[model samples]
Target: MPVAGALTPIDWVTRFDELSARRDRLGAVELDELGLAAWFLGRAAESERAWDDAHRAYLAASDPDAAIRCAFWLGYTLGERGEAVRARAWMSRLFELCGSEPDARAGAIAMLCRSVGAFATGRLDDAAEFAERAVALARASGDTDTEVLATMNRGRALVFGGRSEEGFAYMDRVMLAISSGTVSDRVAGPAYCAVVASCLDRWDVERARVWTRDLSAWCDAQRGLEPFRGECSVHRATVLRLGGEWGEAETTLVDVCSRERRPETLENALYWLGDLHRLAGRTADAEAAYRRAAELGREVQPGLALLRRDAGRLGAARTGVARALGATPLTGVRADLLAAQVELEVDHGDLGVARRAADELRALADTIDTVYLAAQADRAAALVAIATDAPEQALTLLRRSWGAWRRLDAPYEAAITRMHLGRACRTLGDEEAAQLEFDAARTVLTTLGAIPDLARLERLAAGPDRTPAAGGLTRREVEVLRLIASGRSNRDIAHELFLSEHTVARHVSNILAKLALPNRASATAFAFEHGLTQPA
Candidate 1:
């Protein structure tokens, strides 16, 4: 529930409505920043003269796109105010200027300029096409800024297209690039951070922390970056949760959620709260947070995949994660990448599916200059390789991902991929290599205090080399060793005695050490000979 202090929805709507309708005509050609902002927000207090003033200044600016962008925004303001025909005429003028332009990114800019018109009236497909064309043009020109814009636009289309993976990848590239120090686009770093922060739902917290660290530092250094401060705070909270700093994480999220005005912001914060709770093993609290996020996400991105995922766990419906969605298409790298995700090579039921996905993503290297997206492409390809049981291919992709993640200082992702790499190697019978990778990953997980994961790694590493010590076992250890001899899984032991799996594992280790048993076989023989299952 929103605090009583929060502004009512009706009040905001009423204020904005009044602002949009109260335009005066004086100095309508030379609008300043304030004037343009009011016009953009449809505020009633703005005068037509503000738009005029802004238009004049835009014309006076050195950049050609500046004048054209002003023309479109002014036209949009007019259109929103019921001057559709006049707005269309202005848009036509902007399009004309987009052609034969001298700027290196003029083609991309032109494409995007055209897409905005399509997007204005909810012609999402048309907007996607234009944006896609813009991305292609931008990439062709080798302009990283244009590429970033194209990727963001493309990501929007991909999301609308029911290709969440593709949309996520494109946006990830833009965000990763920005956070990793390659923010070459019209969208400012802090602004895009909001978008990135909004995407944390259901993502692995450790993996997310890698990007959040850099993002947090950048947000601190930048001023006038308040638009996304709420989100940044939420991200920090998530990292703290992943690091096992539970109290701080919980406090931060609760505060952020309370203070946030937008449904989107609050919803995102709530979603992360759910994640934090779940990671801490608080099933009930996790469920509540997930329910809230699902309810809120339904309003914006209808049938959100992440919601569907949570709904599944919380006994909610399978409504959101549809196999097929009636989505509008996207243009450029966004579309290409999204298409690639929905068409995961796994569905093809062959090794070629993974290869195709990889190929599709690889084709985008020239389209966007964000290393983050490139890493995703590699990781996606690696996943495909794993599905196809191709260890070599998986290794190659993992290696690429590692390199990119290192440059981005994304240790969590690196650690995750390294774990996968170890698995791939283990499957290929390279235990020595597997053990080393597992050990490295274990160290990182331990620093982050992921006890369960650390224990699992320890177990995996202990699989090949150890034997029980030669000695008599203590009574408690003897009982645990007897269970181990019976071929019981950790789950079975935990259930039988109501002890935690971690505790059971510890007992088993103690037993092995006490009896000097070299292996499970010796422990089993010793237990059978002594009738170790009998009560003392």
Candidate 2:
């Protein structure tokens, strides 16, 4: 095990110099506290794999200070690399180890690192708690760097949870700290640009363009930040994706996925790849990537459930969603926010219960003003709009939802929001506007090869004014097929979609023809297989 205790001044300085040397190779066995700390902090400046290894070694060394250093960097590395499980584990460990007393330097840094990791992995509640802890510790010690980092993490988590204005304040503070020369984050942790891009993407194109320009300059200014090169690409890809550069976005994802370093980063690339594919009408490929990303995100329920839902594997998504919602280690606004996501899926599938769930989410949001949850609640409300047949209402909700999601630099969710907005346009009888929106969405999703979403959009591009995801099936056909697949009689089918038995028979015939099934039995089987119907 690595040792974290203090060392003689000369030996420590020499060891630290060796660890910090750009080209020197130091043996892990010879690592001391200062050496390990130097390596943990500077190794990432050397290489990706080396960075994580150093961080882990530092964490396991058992010196409170060394362990604390390791905890911080390791958490960020794990989260950045997409190892949410390991990241969460380290974060939890840090939380337990820190206890109530504030150790200022080590404690503040460790808590900030943990919170940042949590935020990255979709654990906003935990992120908020850790951020607050870090902030308190930083304030107690007057550690400006830790304070800024913690504030940034809190802002990010809040943005994801839907407390945008508050989150923006944090971002503003981060900027202020930067101006105050107190905004140093180890290993380029301060390089996240997606948030700024998303926040300004909708308001003024010139402003966003200029911000991105400055981002390029800032990235270049930080010469030793090469370890975050892939992350930088991810941020740029997000900006391009939001700016409507679909081809560029696809290219960027391909580049990110091809880098072949860090599991978390790979998972992120795959998630976006899957999303882009879905929007682009490439269902088959999208399904494949989504499956892998979901597996990677298995430690966190939200990521797993969203991927499953995108793939239309509802049973699996539902189970994950239910487990996530039912599992109670969560508190404050994050719980309400996550619950809203599950409820939205439930509401989307079960039209009868959508409104109640939306109402529940709204009421919950009223209790806490967090960034991540508020946006989640808005998404749920949009689902309700679709369920209630108010496309305009859904569009309005999507517009708001898009604003929140964009602020967090979460492109995957942003794509979905855009698609929903297009659906609203279709419902409002503006086929041209809908087509543009769908095309924009398709461009993003095509890169990911999202299957079901692609299939729905393809159906829309070729059909009349209808929600792309609802496919080309008319309302009546959707209803009749639902019942027929449920083993309902012709009479039952007619009653369900609201038509005469003769009309229902005609719908059945058309469905069989449309699906190119040879017989009613085949058509019925198809309906069940395609989720157009439920078992009786």
Candidate 3:
């Protein structure tokens, strides 16, 4: 067998496989090295087998401390693979071993493992308590690996418990230590991933961007760092997607999915691939990718609903998003679902549902205090206001939404908000302001190569120019006239169009004055004469 120090992780895996085939006996140390090689190669089953062998070997050799270490690694790998019950069982064995041996390092590792299991099961208080004990024990034993793991768990618990700022601050300190090389390579990668996950969970994109940079640098410094490199690539790809570099992001995600062996990493990359394809108007490709992601046990949500909306299946989109929102509680993903619900409900002309969704989104944003969620809430509110003929209120909300999106450096969303702002301004008779907003939005959409959005915006901007010259009636007035000609009352028109009855009345009076008609019957005759009424 090759000496562990003489071979790289990949080389060791090959050598170990050869040795296994030859039926060569491995010492406890060699078995542990084999496990490490399997882990670095992303072969979880192989890693677990090697670790189990090493644990048995160490116990037979009367090395309780070595056995405990093996148990900890086995537990960590199982937990990462989402086998929580198996992971907890291994951790319990570690605890029992530590009890007999009374070693501080073993006790700390046991506590950290238990804490992780507790956190996974949603016992945040128990997680925090166990993590604290682990940190204390690790510090006393001078075990930096255990200390870092315990600290990360504690920070995660705090973040999930609603102390985001404090949790992030603590995690930042840990990241700083990793960046400074104070933490070992064994712990650095996991720490970086944990912090990135926490930032993503909280919708702290700016922080995620910063840490992704650091993670990329760290990965570059280590040659052939298999599993961590795949994870770092995932994080960088997410940041790229958020920065509007869709092509690059898609390439990166595809590469990661091709190279990564872990189901979780592959699942996330596939989901992101679907998002990029959907955003680029490739519906078939997006659907295929979403299906693959779902097969990997990922939830295909907001993206799938938005894709259906883009395909003009608004009813299916509404049903899908509404079902998702109804089943999910208020959380980060719920925020995204609610945003999709608002747009779908509004487009379906269910203004009451849209208004309720907006209100709920606003309340959730206020409770979470995330800039992204707040911006989404503002956008939803603006759409509801515009539908209700409250142009002034819509304008205020759109501006707030636009500012937030701009500050978040999300150009596409900012451009969408600007388009809405333009419509609000036009409704309020501010033609110059409306034109400027439209121009700005057009530039962004063009630069981003957002073909569908640009096409939609062009159609909206052309509506006024297409107005019939008989009496200079607006598009909305024409719509109201058509509904009048259909033998619909004002209340019926308001209900169908998602407008207030008062707004419908005002549109009727405007239609009468513009067409120089005396009443609804005359306006109906004019509409039919102008060929504005639908054919039987």
Best by lDDT: 3
- lDDT by residue for model 1 (1-536), tens: 11111211223234334444653433323244445434323342353455555566666665565566566555645664567787778777777767765454666766776666666656777777887888788788775565676677666565545455666677777766565445421243433653454344323233356657655665554333333556778778866754556668789898877777656568868877775555444557766877787688522122233332333332222222122222432222242333334223343334464466466556554344355556767777777665544667789878988788666565655666677678667545466798789878877776665444455567656653233431334334555666777888777977776667876676666566656777778877887777665554
Instruction: List per-prediction Cα lDDT, in the order shown.
Output: 0.57, 0.60, 0.80
Q: Which stretches of candidate 2 lie over 4 Å from their true place?
A: 1-143, 150-168, 179-182, 185-217, 222-226, 295-349, 356-536
Deviation in Å, model 3, residue 75 alpha carbon:
0.9
lDDT of 2 at 403: 87
Residue lDDT tens for model 3, 30-119: 888777767766667888898899999999999987899899989887877879799879988888888865778888888888788788
* Better structure of 2 and 3 per lDDT: 3
Q: Write the per-residue lDDT of candidate 2 for residues 1-536, one digit (tens) a residue.
A: 21111111123235445555743454333333333334333453333344445555655665565555556655655665567787678777676667677478778887787686677669998998899899989898887667777877787787668675677677766654553444443422343354453344222233334445545555544433334445556656656665556678889789878864656566767776765665565667666777777687623455445556656677786666556656553443234335535454543465544565567666655654544446667877886675444666688888888888777565656666777777666545466787788887778666655556666667656664323433455564567677777788998766665556765666677667656779878867777666667532
- Stretches of candidate 3 above 4 Å error? 1-34, 53-66, 100-103, 464-466, 469-536
| Pick by TM-score: 1 or 2, better one | 2
In model 1, what lDDT does residue 436 have?
86
TM-score versus the correct structure, for each prediction: 0.45, 0.50, 0.83
Kindly give the stretch of ten consecutive residues in candidate 1 with the minimal lDDT sum: 1-10
Best-to-worst order by lDDT is: 3, 2, 1
Best TM-score among the predictions, by candidate number = 3
**What is the model-wide C-alpha lDDT for candidate 2?**
0.60
